[model samples]
Target: MNAPLKITKVGNSAGLILPKEVLAHLNAAVGENLTVVFTTRGIELSAADPDFDQQMAAARDVMARRKRALRELAK
Candidate 1:
């Protein structure tokens, strides 16, 4: 869990080479965007634009409240 990553140069950009196991743990693929946050302690990498659960909850609320109106609009 505490694998160290060495910084390496990639053409004009600096990057790290993650092992296949680590990449699988991250569930990341090529071209996927990661949100990087630096704290006083360390850096955190996660999928960008979080709050997916919150967004889904809000969407459910909207769907529940608009069921009738949406049904009417559909006709």
Candidate 2:
């Protein structure tokens, strides 16, 4: 849906207030976190995925523990 967004002062930071329809479209609610991704075209906002966050954390842990191994693999 095409929705015009305006950036307004939000506690010293500029923020956009999502309309109710936009929130519904994103399946998000107030106080919920949204993931921001910067793309070549522009930016993308989406609902945060708990599973992805957990997977990324696990991957980071493994990378830290296997730093040398990972470096060797990269080479």
Candidate 3:
């Protein structure tokens, strides 16, 4: 499942163009956001979870507001 990928210039940033077969295997299309995760082995790419991201943002806001309470509860 290894395919050679080339990094090309896209304005100021560099981008990689995935082959059609790889795109088909990932079920990804143009304009879709992908999440890149860095692991010990290597980098992993997956489709972004918009809903999960939104939920995490909300949780972070709540945690910020309730920092004192959460700290006490953790004791």
Candidate 4:
């Protein structure tokens, strides 16, 4: 699962080419969008989900507006 990847120049920006085996393991195809997440441990790459992102944004807005209500409900 662990494989070394190299960053090569692509036009102006550098890009890393994922191995075919890695792509197949992740069920990713060429031209498919991927999401990069930075955590305390390290960087993570995963398939992008636009629908999930929208839903999370809506949920965050609701939580921000109803913080007290949610706290009371949790009690």
Candidate 5:
């Protein structure tokens, strides 16, 4: 169900008022930063700091592609 949002003042900034249920569902908290991406479809938000599997995969791919160059540089 889409609930109505209340506009409130946060110091000098205006912010959207979210319900407790919504916050609990998202597992977000105050002062936490989320990555928000605006795509052609719509907006998407996720935790910025996720598992390191993707990073490790990227490093492996780069190393595989530049094995010769890296070997030369190591000397």
Candidate 6:
């Protein structure tokens, strides 16, 4: 599904307006969050995973706290 969206001004911030059909295709709605991942190809957008943020935060904390151990294990 390809959507050609235009960037527009929302108050002071610039954002893209996802058309209703596009949002429906994503199984998303207005005011709902979408996860955007920038891969080598381009930007990928999908419906947000509720626990993704928490899992990422936990992983970051673990990496920070176990930096030395992880580095050694990477050898």
What are the lDDT scores of the predictions, listed in order?
0.83, 0.92, 0.89, 0.91, 0.79, 0.92
Could you tell me every candidate's TM-score relative to the true structure?
A: 0.55, 0.86, 0.78, 0.66, 0.47, 0.72
State how far residue 55 of model 6 sits from its true place (Å). Answer: 1.0
Residue 2 of model 2, lDDT score? 88
| Residue pairs clashing, model 6 | none
What's the C-alpha lDDT at position 25 in model 1? 76
Stretches of model 6 off by over 4 angstroms after superposition: 1-3
Residue-level lDDT of model 5, residues 1-75, one tens digit each, is 588888999999998766767666778876666677899998876656665569989999999999999999999
Question: After superposing candidate 3, which stretches have Cα over 4 Å from the reference?
Answer: 73-75
Which residue pairs clash in candidate 2?
none
Give me the runs in candidate 1 sitting further than 4 Å from their true place: 50-75
Q: Model 2: per-residue lDDT, tens digit, 14-41? A: 9998999988988999999999999999
Q: lDDT, candidate 6, residue 40?
A: 100
lDDT of 1 by residue, 1-75 (tens): 888989999999999987777767777877777778899999988766557769989999998999999899999
- Model 2, residue 45: what's the lDDT? 88
Task: Please give, for residues 1-75, the per-residue lDDT of candidate 4 as tens digits.
Answer: 888999999998999999999788767899998889999999988877869889999999999999999999999
lDDT of 6 by residue, 1-75 (tens): 686889999899999987888888899998899989999999999999989989999999999999999999999
Q: By the lDDT metric, which is better: model 2 or model 5?
A: 2
Clashes of 4: 0
Model 5 has a clash total of 0
Model 3 scores what on Cα lDDT? 0.89
Best-to-worst TM-score order: 2, 3, 6, 4, 1, 5
For model 6, state the Cα shift of residue 12 in Å.
2.4
Kindly list the per-residue Cα lDDT of model 3 for residues 1-75, writing each as its tens digit. Answer: 798999999999999998888777777888888888999999998877769889999999999999999999999
